[model samples]
Target: MKKNIIFDLGGVLIDWNPRYFYRSVFNDDARMEDFLSTCCNSEWIVAMDAGLTAKENIARGQKTCPKYARELALYDEGWHHMFGGAIEGTVEILKDLKKAGTPLYALTNWSAEKFPWAKKNFPFLDLFEGIVVSGEEKVIKPNPEIYKRLLARYNLKAEDCVFIDDNAANVEAARALGMAGIRFTSPARLKEELSALDNRPSHK
Candidate 1:
């Protein structure tokens, strides 16, 4: 069977990092790193990924870390600055897959409130037959349930899907559910790896 391709948005297809935006704010790498690690870390942002509204996360962040109130507010207001841009190499691969009539789907850990902006800005997103968003589903990757949801919603068999994600844990989670999991490193590497799997059954 031709395997269905499922992609993770951030880190894989889109170049997104809070540091991209914060670099401008702090203008100092060390200061920015300190702030991100100490005050507004992944814990603070993961809440939004797990379905807490960005507005609510910002408010709570500001209340808890009053010293960085302005920065916290800017986190949401200037979230677009976080994008570096689409990974052109990977995008080209996506276009090729689409041209070949491959069934594509997207599973992303993103905020529900901000996903609309992503859909509007990234035209390449239209290539997907379906998308499963963590924020909307109130579930994030590395959790088996999120993977299960994607398979269930799409009526896809795990053994017939190719899951690609930048995070090792997320890839492992997909593998646990019987899907072929590829840990994204770069577009060239991904292209090579996928080609290697062309004649084989779905396997990591």
Candidate 2:
């Protein structure tokens, strides 16, 4: 079977970062960094991504950090400000793979509430044959169960899939589960690495 390509959406294909939105929210870079690190950090995001509704997360954040209530609420209200657009180089690669008939899929750690916005903004997301979102599943990556869910749902053998993720832990999890893994750094590097993987003789 031709290798099925699984992509991690955020850093790999979409340029999503709270910093982009927060930069405009706070005038001082130091203050912005401190606020992000303190209240609206990655840990908080993980909870939202792991099936907690944005409304719930925002409320919890406000309760825990009342000083930043406005900022926390803005996290959901001004959510569109977080996007920097598609990584065009990676998008071009996706188009090429589509042309070559490679089965494509996405397994992303994204909030379910905000995913509709992404679907509307990024037409390229439609290229995927399937998308397993962490928020929808209530499970996040670097966890073997989530990976298994994707394989089982798609009826895909782990060995037949090539998972690409920007997070080292996520890529390692895929590799541990018998899927070929690529730690995505740049689109150029990804293209070269994927080409090399494709050229290799399949074990089956």
Candidate 3:
């Protein structure tokens, strides 16, 4: 049987810059420090990915500090830019996986707003068998609950799938659940890793 391959969006498929917005919106050292301290963690984005509306999230950003509202709106608008670049070899790798009949999915922690930007920018994702975003599911990664939900959704055994993620914590969570998980070091390395798996049963 072919194994399912799950991808994380931000780092695995779409290139992400951790400080893109801060660089764009903040010129002050103090405000930048404050912004980074208050509104820059994955949790805030995860909350939106887990189903909080973008409008509300902008408000949430604003509530963090009066200066944040405008920047937050820019954050929402520039999300496409935030996640615009594709991993160099990802398209080819995904194509090969499809050719080999491996079931493919993407499990990313992104808000409901992400779909529009992603679909508009990288519409090819519609080709995948499943795409789960935590914002849509109200769950986020590195939390055991999200991995369980993915397993349950596909009715898949924990060991029957391989998860690829850039974050060590998320990858470790998948492994802890008995799934095969690999760290995504880079697009080139990712292709090398997935191609190496062709020697396994799923590739056959």
Candidate 4:
């Protein structure tokens, strides 16, 4: 049987980096990096991905670093600027998978409030048969529950799916759940991996 393919949205299909937009805000690269690393870091962003509302996230940031309250607010205020654009290479792969009649689903650790902007900007997201947003589900990846939720929601067997993610931790989590996991380094590598899997027997 053909394995169902699941994709992660940010960093994989989309070039999402806060630095892309923060450079303009801070003007100085060093300062921008410091602000991002200290105040609005990945840990804080993950909280938002785990279903914290924009308002709450911003407030939490402001409370943590009162000095950068104004800058912290910009996270939600200028959220749309964060996305650089679609990763055309991965998107091409997705299109190819779709054309080949592969079952496609998205399991993304994305903020519910910001996901709409992404959906509007990236039309390729519409190609997925279904997408499970972490923010919407109140869970985040590298956590087994979110992966289990995706499998259950889609009526998919974990052993019959391939999960692709840019984060190694997320990939490991998927593997732990019995789904073949690919730590996507590049679209070219992913294409090669998928081709290799195509010829191999399914994992028991």
Model 2 lDDT at residue 20: 86
lDDT of each: 0.92, 0.93, 0.78, 0.91
- Residue lDDT tens for model 2, 5-89: 9999999999998888888888789988887988999999999899998899999999988888888989987778888999999
Collision count of model 2: 0
lDDT of 3 at 125: 85
Better of 3 and 4 by lDDT: 4
Model 3: per-residue Cα lDDT over 83-163, one tens digit each: 547775777778778888889988888877667777778766876888877877787888899888888887878888899
Q: Which is superior by TM-score, 1 or 3? A: 1
Candidate whose lDDT is highest: 2
What is the lDDT for 186 in model 3?
A: 77
As a whole number from 0 to 100, the lDDT of residue 126 in candidate 3 is 74
The model with the greater lDDT, 1 or 2, is: 2
Residue-pair clash count for candidate 4: 0
In candidate 4, where is summed lDDT lowest over 10 consecutive residues?
195-204
TM-score of 3: 0.84
As a TM-score, model 4 comes out at: 0.96
The C-alpha local distance difference test score for the whole of candidate 4 amounts to 0.91
Once fitted onto the true fold, the runs of candidate 2 whose alpha carbons sit more than 4 angstroms away are none
Cand. 2 Cα-lDDT: 0.93
Task: For each of the candidates, give the backbone clash count.
Answer: 0, 0, 7, 0
Q: What is the lDDT of residue 137 in candidate 2?
A: 91
